[model samples]
Target: MMTKKHLALSALLVAVLATTAVQFFPKTIQPAGITPPATAYRHSEETSSVEKPCSNEHPEWREAQMIEGVDIAPAPACEPDNPYEVATSVKGTNNVSMMTLMQTDLAQDALVMGEDVDKDGDPDEIHIKLEVVELNGSSPDGEFLINTYPIAPGIQPGLWVYAPKSRGMALKNFNSMVAIPMLRAPSPTIRVEQGDKVFITLENTHYLPHTIHLHGVDHAFHNSKGEDNDGTEEHAVFPGKSHTYEIQPRHAGTMLYHCHVQTAQHFMMGLHGIFVVEENHPNNWVQTFNVGAGQVRHPSVGVKNTYSQEYDLIYQSIDKKLSQIIQNATDPRLVAQRMSRDYNMTESFENYFLLNGHSFPYTLRDGIIAVNDNENIKLRIANVQRSAVAIHFHGHKATITAYDGVDQPEASRITRDVFDIAPAQRIDLQLSTQNNGVNSYGPGLWMFHDHVATGTTSDGMEPGGNMAILAYKPLLDENGMPTMHDDLLNEVFSKDYYAKKQALWAQGDFKHLLGDAGLIVPPYWQIILFGLAAGLLIGLALVFTLKRKQA
Candidate 1:
């Protein structure tokens, strides 16, 4: 009874109604392999506000209060006789007991693998457990907290680390600002003896997947029974999961370990650490790992005999735009979408440079390389930064001992003040502090910084980035902090200066020259103006040529 036109119109209306109904009652089905939304590892509420100051009065700052309380010296090694025994209450066992104690004891950052089941003096098997944690790092001035290096007072997302538990007082009870569990750079350095069976277990507590690829170190591609233990992208450990790597390093040298899953992103997110395999020397229970950065207490056989003191110097740069992706979203689903689908790495640029973990002034607070006159110090320097860096040690020359964990021949060992270190490159230098004409200019507060001009600034602010001093013992204060001239500590070097709130050059001060003005005109406008002028000139020339031809 309906006309063809009416019938068609009715059909269209029905289709539209059906589509609207479908929108109201959407399908519950999800695409295959899509991960469900998980809780964020670090919530916004967990981080401290930037405006609030970190409490120095907290018990953790007690050791740093006194000038001499800052212990720059290395913690003594645990005796081989009872390596697992931390205190009278804490005793490590072989079977699950050791693992249980490590988790319960706040003091245990690393588990001592000294179980000699064969009654041999040396440990037959070593087990280490590490957890990936999320935390906020306080800015140097205690003005704000961020997930990344707190060079500027902003909420930058970053990764934190938990070292292998040691048998001692729990870390929670340890009163030190550096020991506080928080996000930082340069993960704990894992030290092992050559020939000792080492088992490193990665406990993925973060929201994302991760794997530990032993970079440069000797490791097996596959473990017994054909399991994928290489810590590659194919064998990523998901959140709440665990993976153990079995490594019996044949050679002893400086090596690297980092998260291999989405390597470019994860590694830049601060998931890498130093791995050292020392020579098999008698009773050589090397300090299992150097968590964060400071003095290396347990030196390797090579370092202990050759140098009076050793320091692990890790250089890294941060691209804040890329790092902020993790902090932009609170939900795991949103984070995955932003990092994998939305973020573009091609446009990323490094804004903050770091030494050890902190920026310039902060680096001097803890990263001072204090040395006595004529003392030989070992500097195990690694360039974890993406860009190339030339480390110029002021007033001294360093003798190169090893390159990329390989010992250089004595004849080929180069002595240079400026060492060009590429990305992921490791250089072990013997810094001789002798006041000789050739070796060193003499004892003084020598500045050791990146030769790259931009490397000295934080977010384009001068005197902010990876600059620190090689202070002589006399220049160091009682707390092991370097004492700089008052001129250096003036308002110019203050946090507000780097934050760009304060002016570098005061008004009416002609002492400093103000640079030339940048281009005020828009680039497109200039291009259009140039095109118009060219067109007018060409028209005039053509008219002149035509008139001449006609005449």
Candidate 2:
């Protein structure tokens, strides 16, 4: 039998051994299949595509690609000899004949001509219809989403946006008997002449309630009936309900219109758009709505006076945690509760950034500024993200013409390479491709992107968010691809690039120097040797102590 002191020492050693063994095995904090099932779906609809007609039979119908609910038909071939003569329907003219816009509306849409009051050839009364649309949403059966708006490659965040009333399927190039509404993010840019009577009818088709708050626009606080005229949650239009707002803005400037219903949540869900008011000019039929900000197809006569091209640049950010909440539940109530109450905005961080409803590579498809030498381009930029963005332009320094739609004083107009835009702030920049050292470096492919480190990343991937290029016409190929590009399009264009699976610079010449050769994992022999060595040291110390005690 062991002595009492030996027994006590053995007990202590056993206690220590037990504690060490416990650390090797850990209990599961959360098990799989723990998420609760959805209760019910708000709406569901079956959507299917139709066959395309043969070009021989239907020569008029051009080949189309569906992008952000817009039909992207290829533009006509560039004729260097004759710059005026061209063929294309992608020019955003609504009713104006292609014959009329052979020269102008190549990148932008034409103003929707309305009945000119006072025989002035300009519209004084404007009526617009908007419907709430749910995009990339899930149903109880999870099959209702037809035209999904994917921000980044392989990512579709559930969104609710206000869209103009139009016939046909929501997505273009999709042939379907079902007349789905074309709902898209950064809702259609609404334009009206300054001091014109404007009526905006909001048709709430989604399950949740919404309201249109004319942000920074002139509107009455209350209507004649003492009802809330300013769009707010208190005066929200319920599901299947409709409300009309009347406003005649006194100023000519760029403004915002967004949902005021639980603004912290609903606004971020993509219920917002640019609202522009042009100075009243006779016969200046303005392009009333620019769905999906890019080129103003039918630019107002006023816009044509100063700038050759105008772009509405709306930048936004999304927190995946908040967007994923919509996918977690089918019940509209649960989604609303989770988004409006359960989710804490302060604790969340933005994971995605968008320019004109698309991330970097996709942004290049439409967001690029194609310019000629000495062309005056107007960029109406709005920062709707939570944080400020330092918009940096490579090879160009633009002059700030306006802020939040107000014209900057001539003396105060500043030319800068990077513009610091805060949340909900609008900045108008006059970009002149003059080749002057002060204005532009030269005719080449240059990048203009957000300088805020995180704003440039999509889910932490570089070259991924709100990044667009300013390409000189000579540098662009017939297909609009940059002729002289540093990057391999085939590599960056792949989904693997955004997915983080493909290693950066793996295909470069310096791959051997920078490639990620996987680090060696601890070998079984090494682990065993380490354990044995530690045990031997412990045993030796214990034996020495026991011998000393015994002596």
Candidate 3:
């Protein structure tokens, strides 16, 4: 009996699904770190597989084990390698498996802001040295200085992973700071406790060129004769180098480490990170290596305390007009103007979209966006950016159980909000407002953009670039940190508390409290003008209830 065109098509499909479940009701990757180790190192039979997201591939590497699908039912005369078993129709093209990761550079916040080396109580294995001088950062002054040392002196552009529950420590001499890493995105984090034993080390000291590809580690490559065993074009570490790469990640999840070179302008000139391997075990301690900041779910409550709760987002993006139109071409003519004058392979967005770098007073250094109950708890997300990232969490719904680092499928537990991710993609979202998620519309002060809509908005301004939120009353303080604390951390430690919030927000009288003004009115056309005024007030309440039932 509801026929005002089905009550204006059910109130315009519940107001366009309550504005896409009211902003995709929140949101949320693949690829575990990588895997491989050493005895004297450098030993590869080579491998590479694809059709094996969870099964069948070549030289074996979807993380050398733990695949749960593909009707696997063959090889088993008591073999001994069971990453979780599942390999039946073993196909051809030698599935995927490649490894050779070595990049280390930590100095901005130093892995979760914790680094207690030699003081006799954990946190110091981050020994750094990097060097790329001259661009204003300085250090050249003598015709390319040929030998200031560290031409990649074993490049470990910062990686101090630790996950103990089954063993996976990848520390290579943990240490940090020397200048010239530049990070900014959502970089700086290193929590662990899920099958630890992930040691890593690549002390290059920098000069230029770098290398660390564990993009989605699996180890083994080009074997059976040919060459190249995932050492990224055969291990690059120029400008004053060193090398130490190992992986024991028997697959536990959420991973990435950038710089595969020219790799989209070296991961957009800030390398990348967020290679967490934490799952907590039956009692384990000893984690200390800082640079981008994050680590210490436990280290004696982190020396005294620093992170009882946290969040790092870092989903980067900034075409700054394509890095100023590829800084006037010239990398072989910008690869021949990207293969003959930019042949639009999807133009790729830009004009700025950063979060941990600056975009809303540098997101106020991570704070301001609240609702109480601690902004609903746990959310790590990281895209690093190139393209593809659709988060949108207004009324909340994020339950993602991990991806790109694996873990999810305990019967798909949790309704999981929405997510799109692509480049580097790393998700850990557990976000909630609780019971059907709601702090009075996910309560207090929420938001967590991108779900497209021009990445929430930036170069076009309405909500200018890579937005932020979900902060609610005390996003973390008492030393646990973060509560709108950006300006690239006092502009990389020049400090002045962001020069007094830009001299009182440039005198704009608090301009909407600069929290990114989240609510949805950002170039999204106000949720299509509130779903066309909720479809003309449900078609005028079904034509006045059909003229009072035809009087």
Candidate 4:
């Protein structure tokens, strides 16, 4: 026998009780076809923080090291110093430390040597296994949501590159225990001797489908089994699948290999690399794959006879808007849709330029061509960027020997300071470190960079892009660091410089005239005008309010 008012109050109380119950035990509404992020990948908090011992003797017993706050045993003096530690040595910079990828032997990790048929010494049957890897992409469970591989200081653009199929954690030279997939780009250079029976396998480890088109490499349109040997989109290898491409290259020169599926987007995202066919020679054990393109530590027979050192220079540019789409979500479908359908390359513009997968300062770490006073250096240059690059040498001119895998005639070889290479074109240059003025201007620390202006900048910041030094042995320290003058390194290498926190001419000769004038104040005349405008607006508002009250 409750009144209507009492019944309504009782109902209200019941609703409040139900709401409190729901607060204690809430149900989640999961979207259809979309998996929860936590189930997708393990988050960074789940990772262990134990300090592990590093041994040069047992290099195989190594683990992947987290680049953050990494404190472990020092690398062996015998091996190359950890480029990661070397890069972050500059004070007042929080640049992500480079992965100890160089520690993992490039020759062994990338090249699978097969049986020597003729038995001159080196293996005749070459097998190269490559896997497609996504870099700087987000994961539901990762510490930063994305595993960021910064190409330049404070700039982490998402990229996908071809990496050699490596197993387990990197054992040596790493500071902490991290996975062993040496994910990097301007993907590994495939170096094989002419007439060698090569089997190039594409292991599609990523979520999307991909193919490797051997551009300019001599191969049949179809394989023996009549499969698409041309590596076109017609025969793409999907995720969790693999395909082996067989070929015996007839020519010997620099060529190219890249994904043919969605070529415009895929190529820009960094699936292409230099494919080199060395001159046919007995016992020519070439460093089959130059992962993270730089110096070829083990020179081929023909190269050894011609040049003192060999380098693979691949230049590329990133359109930030397109490359950054992958970082916006953790789902593969969403990213793929955005890149393939939503992105318009014609409307976008390239921002970050790279030389062998790194911008400047970072380039100084491994991109240096350490030369003696009178030495001949062979440089295999490729321009895979959207725009053409006018590569200029600061202190010397180089002689062009080849173009697009074809050797230029001795009479046709041209020597110049700047060489203009178009998109997808390869040019071979013979750099002479002779102090004879024409070829060499007596190199102290000669810088070689793209003269396209934008090519020398990382996101519009000068001294931040594809710039490297041709350091003479004398100028390089025992650790291979160039003995540069002044506090130039201190200023340029800091994060604040790139972040626009510090003024460009704060330390320059024109500091007094052009230095930072913080918190700029408006002129007295402008301030007076603003005050009069404010008074007028206030007077009008008061008049309107009084009229409304009278009404």
| lDDT for each candidate structure | 0.62, 0.67, 0.40, 0.69
Q: Please, what are the lDDT tens digits per residue for candidate 3 over residues 331-381?
A: 434533653356342565554565544454334333233335533344556
Rank candidates by lDDT, best first. 4, 2, 1, 3
Alpha-carbon RMSD of each model: 14.7, 9.4, 23.6, 13.0
Candidate 3: global Cα-lDDT?
0.40
Model 1, span 1-551: residue lDDT tens: 34476456555655554454445433332211111221122334334322222222222322312111112232221101011222201122333254444433323434545575555345657778777755443333333323333433332334444444333432234333223332345686777778888788887767788888899999888876477767899888999998888888998888888888877777776777778888777655566656565557445555778788988888888776656555444557776787667877677677778887767666665577777788988888888888999999999999999998999999999999999999899988999989887678988889999999989977676676789888887775544455565434443434334544434442234225642222122234445455555555555555576577778
Model 4: residues with Cα > 4 Å off, grouped in runs = 1-110, 142-145, 169-181, 505-551
Q: Find the candidate with the highest TM-score and give its number.
A: 4
Report how far off residue 58 is in candidate 4 (Å): 16
List, residue by residue over 1-551, the lDDT tens digit for candidate 4.
34476456555655554454445432332211112232243324224221111113334222223333432222212122333322222100222322443344332334556677888876777777788877766666453424345565445577889877755443322432222334566688878889888888898988989999999999888776778888999899999999989899898999999999999999999999999999988767665656677776556779889887788999999987787676667678897899898999889788888988877666766577778788998999999999999999988989999999999999999999999999999999999978888999896888889989899988777887898888877786544557763345545554445555555655545468775642122234544455555555555555576577778
Clashes of 1: 15
Which model, 1 or 2, shows the larger TM-score?
2
TM-score of each: 0.71, 0.74, 0.27, 0.74
Task: Please identify which of the two predictions, 1 or 2, would achieve the higher lDDT against the true structure.
Answer: 2
Residue 254, candidate 1: C-alpha displacement in angstroms: 0.6
